[model samples]
Target: PYPQHHQQRQEIFFGNGLTANYQARLRYMIARYAHYDHILAWEVFNEIDLTQAADEQLVSWTEAALDFLAEHDPYQRLRTVSWLRERWPEMLALPNLTLLQVHRYIPHLEHVGPSDSDVIAAMLSDVIHLRHAQRPFIFMEVGHHGHDDSDVPGNHLDRSGVALLQKSWAGFLLGGAGTGMSWWWDSWLEDNDLWRLYAPMQRAFSLIQWDDPGLRPMPVDLGSDMRILGWQSSRQALIWPHSRWSSWHNQLLQPGNNPHLGKRFAVTLQSMSPGRRYSQLAIHMRSGAVVAAHTLHADGHGRLQLKLPPYDGSIVLIITPQP
Candidate 1:
């Protein structure tokens, strides 16, 4: 808990037993960090349920805290609570709340690897309905303990992240949930044994800047063999392999079956219109001894042949459709 004074420093008064000091603390935060764009929203308590508090109590405190803040600074950006899966709806009804976010433990809770798309879709639907048609909701938490000896190393998180992204994008295109964020800030996990396993996923997810026009997803074919690398429907193209720890290769040669190498490279297009400007496609490679970049183009529809050069470490192919 933040020091009572920090909460009171703003003279905050919540109907749920908040002292004036708590409000002061929130005021101090708004006054201090409002200028920074990276701070998404002012997140309230982590898990009110864990504290043995009832939903009504949590909402009352939230109302008081938010009312105090709004009174002092009417333009507070947005508000959210870090909640467990089942309790999200109870929190979304608050009049001043902006979004409903939940932490869902996919395979971990069920003792399995990456959950299926339908399961994710169901959760997303629940989020959409619970908001009372108020604000956009998101999957604020989705992660598994990679270091757990009984668990599979990378497959769970990888598949789950991919599944969630695909389902989320499809939902948004059809108008479902708002946005999402994985558990968070993996830097601290860097030196741990599980870090190496999670590095690829972290890199892949890092490239997604939902706010940036360039990195935004767009529409494209959901090809069968090309391994549904993450795609943003807004961009209308396939997202490249940006993960550093991926199980892929940086070979510059044309993709063909080679038992000696795990790098099986291929690109497929479901449809295209010739003469229309196509996105500039490129591949990035890094070897312990050398670094390289290659660019290619996509012809109208079907599959286009891409020539790759050989390298040691990992390779990422970026498709930038031309306007």
Candidate 2:
């Protein structure tokens, strides 16, 4: 629960007289729970930009709070503030802030596209912009706002779930620290029985050794109708691809109009190590099914081209190295 009035909220967080009290509370929290190894990070607020406090005041307070946490927290756990995209420059610049947090709601507006491609594009844009932060960037909230539901004909229970899934995988492939956490998990995911969508993503992530220092996000071009996002290590790479024109809503509402739903394309690999060759490649669908497998070698310049199978949703490719 939050204060009803903006002024009240501002006073509690930014009041001149409350600084000592706030710092004291933070100290107490660290003292009380710092020993519990499970507590990962300390977030100052859920969405502090919504407060009526002036930008300068919020920034100053956040800096002070983060400083206090850094000094007092025994383990020096991560410090972050979930902030609006409008204030990203200010919040992300804070020296003590360790995580770049973001929130987005897909709307039915024409400009927004509200489609799978649009979602991937938006997330890629966000990761690209926040990459300067060089910290763990995450979408703390993602889903369709209920208030905007009137624009659509019926409930988006299934479509929203698929959108969340796509956003999660795309975010990870595009260099996000983790999957976009869906908003209203109780209503949008659990209540709708859509929680199973996460299982495949979890398994996909488990297959990769994320801690490898050689792995880094690499760009790929799949032409206009398709999108590819992935990362490459010294000898191995992981790629994920989805159709730009396909979305759960499009598949459900206008099936007749989408003849190219599962269109296949030959995608060329890029930015590989020169003179190195990949020994094996496997393509996996969202369900973790191995749709295709090949024992292939990269060309002399270190490029490998593969013909993809027909699939409207997302798929993963694991490129293994030579022994």
Candidate 3:
């Protein structure tokens, strides 16, 4: 219990007895559940930016709250918080708070909303660009547009669940800690039994060496109706190409609206060791099958050109330096 929840929680942040009660509850929760190993970091708040508490007050309260957690908890687990606006640098810059979280749901087009990958990329880019210190960012809450009261379907209302799946993949593939914990898990995904949609991420995520700190997001120049987004370290590179023509809007609302995209695509993978040979495997995202595998040697300019086999939804490409 921190001073960073909705407007109603503001009273607990200020009220004398209320604040003590909140602390007691927090301590009780820790004493009871901290023994478990599976629990992730202690999230200080869901979306503090939505709260009525002032930033200065929230910052002071958060520091004390974090100290309290460290003092009481025997495990001394990781601590973090979430923000919709990313406005509190003082809170984010706290060294003890190692993880930065944001809940993203921005819209695009008239009523089509932003594409799935676009949302992740935008949130990630915001966290990367806004933070005072380098910290791991996670999309703690994400969905098309928060499943609001609008009678009209906002951006991603696809029955196929592809929209949310794309966002999840982009979060991991674009260098996040894991897939975005989409907001509509029970109502949208679970209600429709969309758990199987994430099957492709397991194998594709395994291909990444996440411990490598040098892995950076690399730009992909594509000559097709797709955009390749991923990262590359010295030893390996992983990227996903999602068709620009087939997006949340068209695929969900207007399926097959775009003209037939070519089965083959051409692209140059940049920022690898020049004149080096690498093993490249193009895996189908939906089925997690290796559709194409080849030995690709980069030119002296550090560019490896390749052709992607025909795919419907999306594809994950894995490239590793050959010995």
Q: In candidate 3, which residue ranges exceed 4 Å CA deviation?
A: 1-12, 15-18, 106-121, 130-132, 146-156, 219-226, 257-260, 311-313
- What lDDT tens digits, residue by residue, belong to model 1 across residues 90-118? 56667767756666543443454333323
**Candidate 3's residue-wise lDDT over 1-323, tens digit each?**
55455565665664333276768888898989998999888877667656667777677677777777777889988788776775666887676786777676645334544444345346556556533356677767766664353432543356667667777777666556677777667666766677776787788778777787778776533445667778887667888776666666566657677663656667777667889998988887767889889998888888788667765657788888788
> TM-score of every model?
0.51, 0.85, 0.82
lDDT of candidate 3 at residue 151, scale 0 to 100: 36
CA lDDT scores, all candidates in order? 0.44, 0.69, 0.69
TM-score winner among the candidates? 2
Considering TM-score, which of the candidate structures 2 and 3 is the better prediction for this target?
2
Q: Rank the candidates by TM-score, best first.
A: 2, 3, 1
The TM-score that candidate 3 achieves is 0.82
RMSD score of candidate 1 (Å) = 9.3
lDDT of 3: 0.69
Q: What is the TM-score (0 to 1) of candidate 2?
A: 0.85
Q: Candidate 2, residues 1-323: lDDT per residue as tens digits? A: 24889787687768653366677788789989988988767998778877767887888888888888888887988888887654457767899999777776665434345343356766666667777677887777776655543443223545446667766777678787887877656555665677777877776677677778888887645456666777877667788766765654564445555555667777877555666656443445446666676766677777777556676565687776665
